[model samples]
Target: MARSETESERLKRIAILNARLPRTRAIAQGVLRDPKGRVLLCELSYKREWDLPGGVVDPGESPATCVEREIFEELGLSVTVGRLLAVNWLPPWRGWDDALLYLFDLGVHHAGELDPALYLRREIAGAHWRSIADAAAHVAPYTARMLEVAADAEHPLYLENSEPGRTR
Candidate 1:
């Protein structure tokens, strides 16, 4: 027969059980454009190519909040995350599990408005506004595709693995 458990023991048991449950990883990215229609990309200290301003969603946080939080943490820029731009599902790659990437529209800024020196965080090596063609060459393939779709999207797009076959 089992004896009654103490409150502390019960809490510990629940924590252990939670740790064993499967988890899904979600990332949020923001799309910002300059007055000249150049896309904003940040050079990460850990990666060779540039990426949008965002990061992984923390547990119990919504994707919208995650993007705003990540941008502030990464760029020191407080931005109102606007409409959802795209949702791309990524398969497992680089030894990481599959993840869903949420893209948010951050609207446009005038030329010379954003000063890299004033807002860039330590994790960012640099920030630049580049034409779509130039940004495509500097970002990942999936990112390039997302940019293309986002630029012309009249409404939010949902893609499966960044492919057109599945969109809603």
Candidate 2:
């Protein structure tokens, strides 16, 4: 087995590397179902692929707030941010060793009709409601795991990947 660095050491190394690479913050919101099984997702502009609704977490903002704000901004719908679902640490790159992914469970307040035209202005290529099964196949495995955990109802805030600097 590979020896793992302590959390403190990881933090120190991350701090040093963060000084060089551009730092960015983002929040991914999983808009959950009320009693039924459904969620909201959007296809990103850069990837032009399907993904959860979210965006860069602004400066001096909390992850929960970021998720709520990002969802509203991207989808034009009201959502209530719930408990933390996952925190995925991305792999090292270009003198930078980590990226924090804050995934949150979303309790939608007001649902809206699908409108493909609005997303063009936001640089969002796609947006729609997805059944849990459909979403599981569309997202990354780690993200899929999060959806599995969130939809179970019995388990919330489950952490599937633990390696701090590793990608799933």
Candidate 3:
């Protein structure tokens, strides 16, 4: 027979159970377009191809907040993160654990809005605004898919393995 638990004991047990629940790493990426409708891609020093202007979501941080923070940190630009464009589930790849990527629309930017002399963080080698075709050539496979979906999506898309599918 099981003994009844006190209130404190029950709370502690609940906390333990919560702690043991599986967790997934999250990446928040921003989609920023130039006036000519080209997407912005950043070249990172650590990777061969370009990527969006965002990073891993910190613990206790919201996806939106994480994207905004990462963009500022990487590009030296303060951006307003808009509607969620896509949520993609990535299986473990390149030694990384499975992760959920949240892509948010950062809206379009005018040519004059960007300062040419802004110092990019050391992690970022350069940045460019390229057409979707050009962007696809420069970004990773998953990122390329996200850009394609975001460009045509009238509503948010849920993707699995970089393709649209039923959500788990």
Candidate 4:
């Protein structure tokens, strides 16, 4: 029979097991819209396509918390996260590994209230309010699908590779 383990030993074992498990990266993004239903998209310096405002979730940080933090960090705007919008599974692409992306609502604001010039982050070239159809031409194909699905979805969605999935 095996001897009982101390708390420290148990914790060490758990840590080892945790590290051995598969790690799927998590990304958090927020959908900000205006009364006209135009979505706010950020022009990224690193990428050609404009994208929603958010970033990778840090260790021990919740997705909601991560979006709020990323918004302020990248856009210099303090925002409260709203309801969850969608959960999309991304397959390995563009030299990056697979990741799960959480989309959250950031509520609506008057178009005049948001000024892209004020977002001084180096990574952000600009931000713009674009209609869904118009945004598709400026964003990635997957992002466009995500926007279309999320906008039309009546409830929270679960997507696989940016498309509607069997699981909700």
Candidate 5:
């Protein structure tokens, strides 16, 4: 004779299995350029380096949708997220767990549309438009590498630690 599983036991088993799975964090960032060919970067209040406009991806949200949502929430700019440019796997850093960063194209707009005075979120200290070379100097090293490739990529790429040819 076989014993039937109780609801309590089934719930405990599911909880245990879920806890054992990999739980890497996910981030969605957008690359919005101005007519002058400068990428829009955010000066985050908490970090020294300026970064592309975006935020962490909430659970169950698609990366494309996450980028669109993040751009509006963080900068108060409603943007239509374009094709995914790259999927970069980031290693753990500065006490945060490993994460996958999805980079999407936010399309170009006139520079005047992102005035600092219009900022809606306190997390953003300001917004800057920088050329690829200039942005590389101010953003994180990983971000710099990602920009180097993703900026000119005609198709999507998979990067590891923001470096090409390392995807696994």
Candidate 6:
């Protein structure tokens, strides 16, 4: 005869899984700067905090692809994502365990109209190009470091193992 599993045990397993999900959520962030040298910032609905324009890497999506897709969806513009910037390892916040953030240098070109249609598509309450220093002061510390690197155009940001070359 075999022993049967209990409902309590099943519930415990689900609880464990739920706790682990956030731990595995890896994010890709971008520090996009327009030609005028202002960095783009977005106001998230969750914290209502201003942040750099970037998001998580979807299942089977490359970091570059994620960044570009985020740009079009959020800003309503076709963008050229440049060199890799910094890799931030965020320990769990708000009951999450772990997160890996890949920061990239994004180049914005005025390629579309910023109007109601685009604004209504995303949860972006506002979109604006702010001075790097000003943007840095408003976002999280990890993002602040990203802006610090991006502000210095002479010193291009690169990932840990990426070779010397601009992505696009």
**Each candidate's lDDT (Cα)?**
0.83, 0.63, 0.85, 0.89, 0.88, 0.66
Model 3 worst lDDT run, 10 consecutive residues: 112-121
| TM-score, prediction 6 | 0.67
Per-residue C-alpha lDDT of model 2 across residues 49-84, encoded as one tens digit per residue: 477777667878887888777766766666778777
Maximum-TM-score candidate:
4
Q: For residues 1-168, what per-residue lDDT tens digits would candidate 5 score against the true structure?
A: 999889999999989988998899999998899988989999998889999998898989988888888778777788998889999999999999999999998899887676566675568988889999998889999999999999779999999998885534
**Per-residue accuracy of model 4 over 68-120 as CA lDDT, tens digit each:** 99888788788999888899999998999999999988899777776676775
Ranking by TM-score: 4, 5, 3, 1, 6, 2
Alpha carbon lDDT of residue 52, candidate 2? 75
In model 6, state the lDDT of residue 39: 72
- Provide TM-scores for the models: 0.82, 0.64, 0.87, 0.91, 0.89, 0.67
Shift of residue 116 alpha carbon in model 4, Å: 3.6
lDDT of 2 at 59: 79
**How many backbone overlaps does candidate 5 show?**
0
After superposition, candidate 6 runs with Cα above 4 Å error: 1-23, 110-113, 120-122, 150-168
Q: How do the residues 1-168 of candidate 3 rate in per-residue lDDT, one tens digit apiece?
A: 989999999999999988998778999998889878888888898889899889999999999999999878777789999998888999898998899999899999875666546636577888888988888789888888778776668899988867897956
Across 27-82, the per-residue lDDT of candidate 6 in tens digits comes to 77676666777777877666656887777889889887887888688766666677
Question: Mind giving the per-residue lDDT tens digits that candidate 1 earns over 1-168?
Answer: 989999999999999988997666999999888878887898998878799889899989999999998877777677889899888888887788988999998888764655676655557887788988888889988888888877668888887666654523
Q: Which stretches of candidate 3 lie over 4 Å from their true place?
A: 1-11
List clash counts for every candidate, in order: 0, 0, 0, 0, 0, 0
Q: Rank the candidates by lDDT, best first.
A: 4, 5, 3, 1, 6, 2
